[model samples]
Target: MEQAVPSSSLEQSPLQQVQARIAQAARIAGRKAEDVTLVAVSKTKPAEAILALIAQGQRVFGENRVQEAQAKWPDIRTAHPEVALHLVGQLQSNKAEDAIALFDCIHSVDRPSLVTALGKAQDRLGRKVPCFVQVNIGAEDQKGGCAVADLPALLEQARSAGIEVIGLMCVPPADIESAPFFALLDKLADDSGLPCLSMGMSGDFEVAVQLGATHIRVGSALFGER
Candidate 1:
């Protein structure tokens, strides 16, 4: 596991380097670098690391658990009011209300039940957070995304329940060439008429941006291994 760095060291260099790489990849793909949003994955990382990134102008962050985010982010957000928090891990239906209260976006809405729960939460809270439907592009049994065949129905269900379905998200199979999977996700987003694709992580985010990823979740590169 990688440990967190001190806040004093969280300068613009790390973020600048990543941004430069993203720009290069986007240029190669004929897309503007500004079109891709970099979401710093802060799972298992300390609040200090997040603060450091924020100091460097990182406005977006991804967290893997509702409980963990709840423990640290409320205060953090209070200090940095412009930050946007995203839930990028498997979310239980029972935590819908809590998730809705904390996150500005959700990238793991992969089932009809979660849609219903989130819709109800939105109605109750009078807030509509953008959501991304996770697709099981790799068909991995252990993954949390909706199966490829079930995507359309799940999307329709989410829309009908008053959830704002903004885009599609996926985690490609690990230890394999990811461009093909990224391309597939882009194709799926195009076919569905969705505008956002939240794929790619620390290792393959550049490839993901080249393949039309609108949002890339990066953790280790920004923080450290965990």
Candidate 2:
């Protein structure tokens, strides 16, 4: 008879499982997992929940709102200053300064007005925050990203406004095939000479990985259901 092994040791934490999936996806794409950055989407998760992942070695996180992030991250940052936070939602023109103060990166820059606000904030604060220009790949009116037709003008405006535009971010239409959308975003980023692509989420991140996603925002896959 074969010896029995410990069942406890066979189970993997959610974070580990996600990381393993990321690695597998990267390998399938002939890419290094180290080249991919997983932004643990901690938006709406409580402080305790975030700390659970922190204990599990997740150092980068994504939050959707400035006020909510302010309420949660100050103490968390004090405890773990190495944690890098990204603002991964629609940023309001009024919240630019606050967003600048809280997030290490802003991934929702879509309009010229927002670019202007962020630029002014960066100037007044005497610090610069790198930003990802969110592109509405599917051109959905309800979404927050800029329209495909406006991308060039917006990028130019952001550059002239002095915002550190680092790359592009997008959210594909829900319940439809996301690969084509991801592929388009990848092409758009490449055409614009941007080096980073912040696409993918809990469900379609693997596809995003295969298409050159530098950052993947994973929420439930890493933290379990809300």
The candidate scoring highest on TM-score is 2
Write model 2 residue lDDT over 1-226, tens digit each, in one string: 9988657535988788788889999999999999999999998899999999999899999999999999999999999999999999999999999999889999999998899899999999988999999999998989999998899999999999898888999999999999999999998999999999999999999999999999999999987888
Any residue pairs clashing in model 1, and if so which? none
lDDT per residue for candidate 1 within 1-226, as digits (tens), equals 9999866546547788789889999999999999999999999999999999998899999999999999999999999989999999999999999999999999999998899999999999999899999999999999999999999999899999999988999999999999999899888899999999999898999999999999999998878788
Q: Which ten contiguous residues of candidate 1 have the minimum total lDDT?
A: 5-14
Model 2, runs deviating above 4 Å: 1-10
TM-scores, each model vs. reference? 0.94, 0.95
lDDT of 1 at 214: 95
